[model samples]
Each structure stands twice: as C-alpha cells, then as structure tokens.
Target: MAAAYEELDRDSFAALTLDRLARRSGVHVSTIRRRWRTVEGVVVELLAERSSMLPTPDTGDFRRDLTQLTQAIADFNNALRNRNVLQGLLAAAAHDPRVEEIVRAAFVRRIEEVTLIARQAVERGEIPEDTDPREVIAALAAPLYYRVLILRGSIDERLVHTTVETTYQATVAGVFVRKESREGNRKGDREG
Candidate 1:
C-alpha cells in the first residue's frame, strides 16, 4: 500500500482504491476490505504507523536533545512516502470527521510521547520547572508542519537549525512556562 502511494503524485491519494492497495500489498481484496473498509481508513492506519517512528532523544543536554528531535522531524518529513501519507490524511481530515478524529488522536499520541523530552529537560534543570511540555513541543514542531503542509516546501537544514535554536531560546526564556506559573511569578514580583 505504501508502495502504491509512493508510486503516485502527492495529490493522487484520492484516486487510490482497495483493489490497488490489495494488489500492492498482495493481500486479498476481501481481507483488505474487511480490515480497512476504505482507502482513507488504510491511510489513517498508515499515518499512525509511520508517525510513531520518530525517536525521542535523551542526550541529557537540552540543546542537543532539541537538535536531535528537530532533525528526526526533518528526516520524517523529508521522505516522500511519509509526507504523502500525512498530506493525504490531513487533506481528508478537512472533510471527514472520522479521519479528523483519527488524525487528531495520532498527533496527540505523538505529542504525549515527545513531551517526555521536555519533561526530562525540566528534570535536568535546563528548562523552567513549570514549563508546559506540550507547548514546548508544539512550538518546536509548528514551523516544520507549516513549511511542509502549508508552504508545500521541503525540509532543509536551515529550517531545522532555526527551529531548534528558536524553540530552545524561547523555552529557556520561559516563553512556554504555564500561565499559572507566569501569574505566580508576577505575584511574587509584586510582593517582593
């Protein structure tokens, strides 16, 4: 099925059929139909499968960790197959509630998995104790997605470097510190 997607243009996912997928995967059409029901369903599953391949770095240095994570994201988006899978699923999610739900769930899972990187940075005293891990990760990733999905551009080394550097600077400056933390800090400042 992935091969079939790779063989076509990025926007050709809509033309995909169960028969094509079955032939590509060497699975019976009945089995494919019973399992996935539709090409969108199969793509949703592929998104889940491929998105999970990103590795969370535990290099113990916050900057290094961010660099590694950003590079991993770059590598993932750099692949035509993975990018097509994401592009197809996201385009489908715009009109299909089921696809939207699955896509959202898949991203939420990835966020949760990568949040540990930020949490570890906190433990190492590299970031603020009250830093919101989710926000941190989101800040780090939003630009890459924008470049790929919005700009329809490819990931380059310069973007990766800027992403890591900016996110790291913002995080260290308490840009992603939780609202509660910000409020408390303000209160403490006033009292002092």
Candidate 2:
C-alpha cells in the first residue's frame, strides 16, 4: 500500500484501487478489501500512521518534555515527502470536509497526548490547578503550524526554545486558566 501511495503521490486516490494496492503490497485483494472498506479508509489509516509519529514522552522535565514533542512535529513537517503529502491532503480536504475532519481530528487526538504533561504539571504544582491542558497543548503546537504551514519558515533551536518558554511563561501567568475558574477567583478575592 505504501508503494502504491508513493506512486500515486501526485495522482488522486481514485488511482488506488484494491487490485492496485494488492499488486503493490503483494497482499491478497480480498484481504485488503476486508481490512479497508474503501480507498478513503486506507488513506485515513495512512494519515493516522503519520500522525502518530510523535510520541508523548515524560522526561521529568516539563519544558524539555514538550520541546521534544514539538521538535518531533517540526521534523515530521520538515520531511519533503511528508510536506507534499500534507499539501495533497489539504487539497483533497477542500472538496471533502469528511476527509478534512478526519485528518484534523486525528492530529488533534495526537496533540491531546501532550495533555499528560499539563496534568503532571498541575499535580506537581508547577502550574495552577485550573490550567487547561487543551490550551497549553494548543500553544505548544501553534507556532510549529505557523512556521511550517503559514510562514513556510524553518524550525530551528531558537524557535523550539521560544515556543517552550512562551508556553511555560503563559501557563505560569494563568493565561491558560479556564474562564470560569478566573471568574470564580475574582469573586473569591472580592469576598476575601
């Protein structure tokens, strides 16, 4: 299937049929059909595989831990074929919202893995208990997205340092605290 995908890089998924993937993978067409209901399913699984390239590691250093994760993301986007595949996915997504949603959701789900860091930070009192994991995780990834997708800039050591530092500082400043929690804190202060 990967061979077929490499061959069909510039071509549409319609070019990838069960027979074609079977020939490329040397797997039986019936098995392929049973495992993957459609070409879209095969693509989704491939995207999932790519998305999971970054793992959530706990090095006992909160800032360093997230920096490593973001660095992995940067490296993945830096690969030429991966970038091309992403652009192709985006083009396909323009006409197919389902594909867009699936890919987006898969990436988001992967991002959620970093939420463990946030949780650990809260437990260690490194950050406020009300800090939202989703916000912190989003902050960690947004700069990488901007660098790779929007600005087309390169991700270097400085960018990685700044990204981690900025998120860490923001978290400490309560920038990621939930709105309701902030409101309640204000009320508590007034009462006190």
The candidate scoring highest on TM-score is: 1
Assess every candidate by TM-score.
0.90, 0.78
Model 2: which ten-residue window has the lowest total lDDT? 183-192
lDDT of 2 by residue, 19-106 (tens): 7778778888888889877566677777778777668868877777777887887887776556655655676678789879987898
Residue-wise lDDT of candidate 1 within 1-192, one digit each (tens)? 564555444446766778777777788989988978888888887777777777889988998988999999898888877787788788889988998999999898899899998999999899997888888889999999999999999989999999999999999999988775677755433212
Candidate 1 lDDT score relative to the true structure: 0.83
TM-score of 2: 0.78
The residue pairs in collision within model 1 are none
Clashing pairs in 2: none
